[model samples]
Target: MGKLTGFIDYKRENKEERDPAQRIQDWQEYDAPFSDEVLSRQGARCMDCGTPFCQMGEEIHGATSGCPIYNLIPEWNDLVYKGQWKEALNRLMKTNNFPEFTGRVCPAPCEGSCTVAINDPAVTIKSIERTIIDKGFENGWITPRVPKERTGKTVAIIGSGPAGLAAADQLNQAGHTVTVYERDDRAGGLLTYGIPNMKLEKDVVERRIRLLEQEGIDFILNTEVGKDISAEELKHTYDAVLLCTGAQKQRDLVIEGREADGVHFAMDYLKGSTKKLLGSEVDGEQSIDAEGKDVIVIGGGDTGADCIATALRQNCKSIVQFGKHPKLPLVRTEANMWPQYPNVFSIEYAHKEATAKFGEDPRQYSIQTKRFVKDEQGNLKELHTVEMEKVQDENGQMAYREIPGTEKVWPAQLVFIAIGFEGPEQEVLDSFGVETFNQKADAKYGKFETSEANVFAAGDARRGQSLIVWAINEGRELAHKVDEHLMGSTVLPSYLEV
Candidate 1:
C-alpha cells in the first residue's frame, strides 16, 4: 500500500545474528537490529495481496496458518516504509500489548502464511516489529497510559505470566482495579525464570513490568494463591477472579533407576540458571551443576534446545539430545504443505551452538529412553535408549513402537526431562473447583466461567501449554468476555472475530 511496485523491486532481508562461536560465550541476545535505511527497505517488501492471509490466524490440518493475535501487519509495514516510527508503534500496540516480547520469542506464523513466502521471501515482519518497539522506548514515546475513569469493580488475577500480565493490562485500561499475584519473588513467571537469559534478558521483562506499575496495576509477589492466601478469601475479597496460572506439571520419565541423584526436571535446571544469572541465590544440594559433566537432555522441542545451549554455556563436558519422533525434512512434505505449519527441519540457535562446540548436532532422533542406569553412589551414570518405528494405531493414527534390537547406551550424570507439560498444576485448579474440558486445560464451549459465577480461566492453565501468541490471543479474548459479563456489554476488541 505504500508503493505500488515496491514488492517487485524489494527483496526480503532480516537482522543478522552474531557469529555462533562468539555469541555463546555470553548470555546476551545474538540478533542485531537493522539500521533505519535497511529496515525501511525491508518494510517495502510487503505485497498487496487481495486477501492477506497472514492475519487470519487459522489452524489448517493440525498446523497454524497465520498470526494467532492477528496483528495488523500491512498497516504497520506501510507506516514504517514512510518513516513513521511513532505511527508504526501505535499500530503495533493496537492489537499486541507486548510486541517486544512476541517480537523476540514468537515463531512468527504470520510470515509463513505471507503471500510473498509462496514464491519469494516474506517481509521481515518480526524484525520491523522489534524495531518499532525499540524505537518507541528509545524516543521516550512509550509511557504508562492510566485510564481516565475507574470502574467500581476490582479483579484479582493469579499468576504473573504472559497471560496474567495481558489480562491485567486490559482490565486496567478498561477502568477497573487490577492486582496480579505471583508465586515467585519476581513478577514474570517463565519469562523471569524458565527462559534462558541469552534468549531474553531479565531487564527487558522488568522494564515492561515497571511500565505496568506506572499505569496503576498492583503486583503482589512471593504469594501463592491457594497456599499463602486461601481461595475462599480471594473469592470474597475481589469482584471476580481470573486464573492465569501456567501449565507447569512436568511429565516424568518413569524407568529403572529413575531415582538417581543427578536426575532433575528441565524447568528446575532452567529456573536455577536464570536465578543465578539474576543474582538470586539457589538453595544448596538441589542445585544443578552442569560444569564438567556429561549432560543428556530428553525431548526435542524448544525447551530441550534451551537445555543443550545452557549446558554448553555452563561448560559441560558434552551434550546429547534425545527425541522420540523422527527428524523432520528440510523442505515441506506432502503431508505438511504451505499455508499450514510445515514439518520442515531447521536448526535452532541452541542446536547450532551445540554443533559448533561439540562437533556434532546434539540431537538423536527416533530414539526413546528405555531406562536410566545409576552408579554405585546412586548418581545417574548412563542412559539406555532404543530406536523407535512409526506404526499405525487401532484408529489408524501413527504411534511410536520401540524397535526390537536397537538398544544402545550413552554416558551421563545430568539428565533434564523436557517432554512437555500436561496441564495446570492440580492444586490451584482443584482449589477453585474448575473442571477440565476436552481432556486438556482449555475450558469447554460457552463456559470459560468456572462452576462458580464470574470466575474465569485462560492461557496455559486453561488451554494446556501452548505458544506465546496463543497466550496473548487468550488474554485478549478473555478480557472481552470478562468485560461483557461485568457491564452486560463491551467495547474491548476481540481478534478472533476481527
Candidate 2:
C-alpha cells in the first residue's frame, strides 16, 4: 500500500455523471472525467487486506465474485496512489486486454466482492481502471507492441465480439498469424453495434481495433463462415480454427400475434439505431422508429434496460419495461452475503433516465405478456399481460403462477423483445460438425475444444451468453489452449492457473 492509513484518510468518491435529462438528448457517454488528483485519492481508498477478494475471480452460488479476468487490483491501486500512472497501466494490461470495454460496460462484480464493501462503500475500481487506460491512450503510452518473431502458424477465428477480439489479441501476441472473420460490415461484433453509443462510443471500439491491426492481426469483415466460406475451407486453410462466434440467436416471444408488424428483437432494433447513427441507412429505410409511439420492452436484463434508454433517446411517447420475475429486494439478503454477487435491486443509468423523463420508474415487474394485439392491417396496437406471483413447486423449484384477476392490456405500438439468448446459432455449429452438450447452442467441449480435430470454441458460443468480462476471460484462456495445442507449449499466462 502507498500509505498505511490511506483508507482512513480518504472517503470513496465516484465519477460525476451528466444530468439524466441533459444526457438523454445525445448519445455520448454520461460520465464526466475526473482529475488525476481525485482519481489518485479514489485509488488510495484500497485497504491493505491480507487476502484481497477483489481479484479472486471466484464463482459463488452460481454467480461471479470479483473480476473474471483476475485483474491485479491492489497492485495497480498502489501504483496509482504513488503517482505511477504508466506502471499502473502496465499492470492493468498484464491481465486485461480490453480494460476500456470492461470499464465501460462491465457491472463491476469486483466491487461487490471487495473487502472494504463489507461495511462501507467499495473503492471505485472500475472508474480507476477506465482512468488508467484512458490516460495510457492520451499520453501515447499505448502503442502497437509488434511481436519480435512470428511462429509461422496460421489461425482463423470466427466472430469479432469481445471473446473473439480477446483471443485474436492474445494469439497475435503469442507470435501466431491470426486472422479474425466478422459477419458484420465492421469488426467489433456487439461492441460496435449491439451496445448503444451512450454506454460505449463506437470510436472507442475502433481505436482498439486499429491498435490490433497495427500488431499484425488481420481482420476480414462482412464474411460469415459456413455460408460465404465453407467450414471445410477454413479447416484446410489454417492450422487451427477457433470459433468465438457469440450466442446471437435471440429468444423469441412465442405468443399470439407475434407476427404482427412493429414487433422486433432487441438486437435488430439496437443495431438499426446504431447503423442509422453511422449514416449507413437513410430515413424511412429499415429504421425502427420509437418516436411518439407507445413502446413496450420485454425482459428485465441489461439488454432490456438498453432498449428503454434507446426509446427515450428516440423520443418515444411512453415506455414500459416488463420483467417476468418479481422485483429483487432493496438490500442484500442472508443468501447473498458479502463477497458474493448481491441479488439486490439497482436503478441503472437507463432506468434513472426513464424515471427523470417520465416522473416515475418505467419498470413493471412480475408481469408476463399474454398476446400482442393487432389492428386489421396487422400492425401492433396493444399488448395483453397478466400479473404473476412466485411460489415453490412440489419439487422445491421456484415457479410463477398467474394471478386470477390481474389481466390487463396497454397501448403499445412498438415492442422490443430483450429476453436473453438461448445459445449460439446452430447453423455455425452444424457447419463445423460440432455437437452440443445439451439442447442449447453451447458446443460440447471440455475447456474449449469441440468435437472436431483442430477446431476450438470459446465465449458465449461455448458457455452461453454471459457478461463481457466473462467473454474476455474465455478468450484469453482459449488462446493459451490453442497456442499450446499448436506448438506443444505456450508462454502465454493462463488466467485460471492462479
Candidate 3:
C-alpha cells in the first residue's frame, strides 16, 4: 500500500458530473475527470487489507462481485498514489484490453466488493481508473504495439463488439494475422450504437479501432458473414473462425397493440437515434422519433435507464419507466452481504436528469404492463398497467401477482421495450452450423470450443448477455484457446491470473 493509514485519513470522492438539467440538453459525456491531486488522494484510499476482494471477480448469488477481468486494483492504486501514471497504465493494460470502455460504462462491481466498503465508504476506484487511461492517452504513453513477426497463420473473427475486439487485439498481438468482420457500417457492436453517446462517446471507440488498425488488425465493415460471404467460405479461407457475435435477440412484449406504429424495441429505438445522430440513413419504419411525444419505457435495467435518457434528449413531452420488480432497498439486505455486488438503490444518470427536468424520478416500480392502447390513427396512444404484489409460491419461489382493480392508463405516444435480450441471434449461429442449447452457443468456457471443429464461440454469444468485463474475460480466453487450437501452443495471458 502507498500509505498504511491513508484509508483512515481520506474520505471517498467521485467524479464530478455536469448539472443534470444542463447536461440533458447535449450529447456529451456527463462526468468530468478529477484533478491529479484529488485523484491521487483518492488512489491513496486503497486500504492495506490482508486480502483485497476488489479484484476477486466472483459471482455470488448470480450478481457480479468484483472485476471480471481481474484488474490489479491495489497495484495501480499505489502507482497512481505515488504519481506513477505510466506504471498504473501498464498494470491496467496487463488485464483489461480496453480500460477506457470499462472505466466509463462498467457498473463497477469492483467497488461493490471493495473490502473498505464493509465499513466506511469505498475508494474512488472507478474515477481513478478513468483518469489513469485518459492520462495515458493525453501524454501519448499508449500507442500501437505492432507485432514484430507474423505466425504465418490467419484468423477471422465475426462481430466487432467488446468480446470480438478483445479477441482480435489479443490474437493480433500473438503474431497471427487477424481480420474482424462487422455487419454495421462502422465497428463497435454495442459500444458504438447500443450505448448512447452521453455515456460512451463514439470517438473513444474510434480511437481504439484506429489503434488496432495501426497494430495490423484488419476490419471489414458493412458485411454480414452469412449474407455477403458464406460461413463455409469463411471456414475454408481462415485457419480458425471465432464467433464473438453478441447476444442481441431482443425480447418483445407479446400483447395486443404490439404492432402499433409507435411501439418499438429498445435496440431499434436506440440504434435509430444513434444513426440519426451520426447522419446515417434511417428509413421511415426505423425512425422512432420521441420528440414531443409522451414516452413509456418497459423494463427496470440499465437499458431502460438509457432509453429514458435518450427520450429526454429527444425532448419528449413526458417519460415514465416501469419495472416488474419492486424497488430495491436503500441498503444491502441480509441476503446480499459483503463482497457480493450490493443489491441496493442508487439513482442513475437518467433518473437524476428526469428528476431535474420533470419534478419526479419518472420510475414506477412493481408495475406490470397489461397492454398498449392505440389511437384512432392506429398509433400508440396510451399504456395500461396494473400494480403487482410480490408473493412466494408453493415451491417457496418468489413471484408477482397483479392486483385487481388497480389497472391504470397513462398517455403514451411512444413505447420502447427494454426487457433485455434472450440470447445471441439465431441467424449467425445457424450460418456457422454450431450447436446451441437454451439459446446459447454450445461451447465450453475455458476451452471456448464450439460444436464444429476449427471454430469457437465466446462472450455474449457463448454465454447469454453479460457485462463488458465478462466479455473481455471470455474474449481473451477464447483468443488463447484459438491460438492453442491453431498452433497447438499459446503463450497469451488470460483472465485466470490475479
> How much lDDT does each candidate structure score?
0.85, 0.90, 0.90
lDDT score, residue 120, model 1? 76
lDDT of 1 by residue, 97-119 (tens): 88888888888888888888877
lDDT of 2 at 467: 87
Task: List candidate 1 stretches off by more than 4 Å.
Answer: 284-286, 393-396, 437-446
Cα RMSD to native, each candidate?
1.9, 2.1, 1.5
- Residues 194-279 of candidate 2 have per-residue lDDT tens digits of 99999999999999999999999999987887779999999999999999888999999999999999899998899989998887
Could you tell me the lDDT of residue 160 within candidate 3? 98
Model 1 residue 125 lDDT score = 88
Model 1 weakest 10-residue run by lDDT = 437-446
**Order of candidate numbers by TM-score, starting with the best:** 3, 2, 1
Extract clashing residue pairs from model 3.
Answer: none
Best candidate, TM-score-wise? Answer: 3
Q: Model 1, 174: alpha-carbon shift in Å?
A: 0.6
Quote the positional error of residue 215 for candidate 1 in Å. Answer: 0.3
Model 3 TM-score, all chains together: 0.98
As a TM-score, model 1 comes out at 0.96
